[model samples]
Target: MTFKPLLQHFKEMKHYFIVVVLVFGVSFYLGWANSEQFSHFLKDQLEGLKSLSQSLSNKDNPQMWFFFIIFLNNAVKSVAIIFLGLPLGILPLFMLVANGMILGYVLSLQTHESTLSIVLKGILPHGIIEIPVILLACAYGLKLGMLVWKSAAQIFVPVANRTASAELKKVLTLTKPLIVIIVVLLLLAAIIESTLTYWLVHL
Candidate 1:
């Protein structure tokens, strides 16, 4: 499928993208500035990830395992958020906030390396593709959430079915193409994270 449809979806749903960005930005700042308040929760998350990492490391061809794990985790979650948004968009928002905060919290933590070093060596390599792709998925998810409300309103107001159907078509039409885009980019990102970023951080 052509990437143009996904780009078109972005154009139509720019507002949702803006809202996602704003929410993510504010949450990131909160996570960075008030990390202590979130430490109890964030630490648990980190611990779980660390456990997973250690287990994966023991496996033969750890890098290959990492690639599969990372790509599947991200891809499945990304797709889930799109449909999970059907319930007033709560899950996608939560995912956006949690992911954003996790990033910010990690960046804010003190370490032997400089902040720039951590960013350059740890995040930028994979995150450049991973971040935007995730955000794009969330924006569509948010749009779907908004449509859910509108659909509910129509039950009472009784507007033309065509208008409602078209609005839905506009969003649903992007699903396949968007999933393809997310999966493809995230695969590349997984490769980078597993190989390049892993190598850099270890060194």
Candidate 2:
């Protein structure tokens, strides 16, 4: 799409972006503070994925599988946030909190220096793009939830029906571009994560 529309989209979604960031920050801090607890929680959750993770990790040329897995995971999450926002936006917020807490809990296990090094060498390469895409998806998801609320609240008012219809149309129009951007960024992130991130951490 054109730069103007993209820029406009960013401006419109700025507030939601900030909200997502704040939510993430608070959850991250909580996770860090209760690292031991979250650690146990995460471990239990991860237990089911251990075999899958191990299998992926053992590949001699894991990049293909890594990219496929990461891309699929991100795509599913983005779709969930966007579509599931109709349920009062709770799903999108849950995603932000869950990811933030896991990230914080995992980081807390590392030494300060190691954490810094990891952030710089491992996360930054792909995270720069991936994080924003995630936040944008969440912001749009929250926006969708707001739209649903607005439509529901004005359901009884005849005049409000037209307004609600317009709003729904607007949301649908905006979501198309958002989904496209998210897909592109996630693809890039998958590539970098499979290559640059892998090499950096292994080094």
Candidate 3:
């Protein structure tokens, strides 16, 4: 499938992307600043992720299973954020904050030099691709949330069923392709994470 339109769409939503990034950055700073205080809390809140990271790190043959687990986790998370944005986008924003908090907390556990090493070796391989995909998903989710709000506002006015249906169709038409692209990108990211990132970090 052609990704030109999808890329263009993401470019158009630059404001949403910036907002999501800023929110993540703010939360990340908070987590980093209070690393000691937040460490236990983050560990408790992200037990599953901790377990998964441990499993991935400890495994010798982490190829197939690693790919499967990471892919499923990311796919579910991305889909959840996008769909849950239906509630005026609050859920997506929360998801972004949660992610930033987790990242910052985890990174803060290391010394500055170690943190740089970890990011360069452990995260950057797949992160280069994965991060942008996530931002795009968040942007689309926010857009969907705004659409939901607009549709809700339309309820107060008299709108024809046919017109609403057409509008919905237009939305679906735009959303479906974007979802496909996100899924594809996530799949590639999972592959890179399981293979290249796994190797680099272990080395």
- Find the candidate with the highest lDDT and give its number: 1
Which candidate achieves the best TM-score against the true structure?
A: 1
- Give the C-alpha lDDT of model 1: 0.88
Model 1 per-residue lDDT at 185: 95
Q: Give the per-residue Cα lDDT of candidate 2 at 37.
A: 65
Ranking by lDDT: 1, 2, 3
Q: Report the Cα lDDT for residue 116, model 3.
A: 92
lDDT of 3 at 108: 83
| Residue range 47-71, candidate 3, lDDT tens digits | 9876877787677876878898988
lDDT for model 3 comes to 0.79
Comparing 1 and 2 on lDDT, the stronger one: 1
Clash counts per candidate, in order, are 0, 0, 0
The reply for model 2, stretches above 4 Å from the true place, is 1-6, 48-50, 157-162
- Residue-level lDDT of model 2, residues 129-171, one tens digit each, is 8887887788878888887887877776656245765766777
Sorting all predicted structures by TM-score, with the top scorer first, yields 1, 2, 3
- For candidate 2, the lDDT comes to 0.81
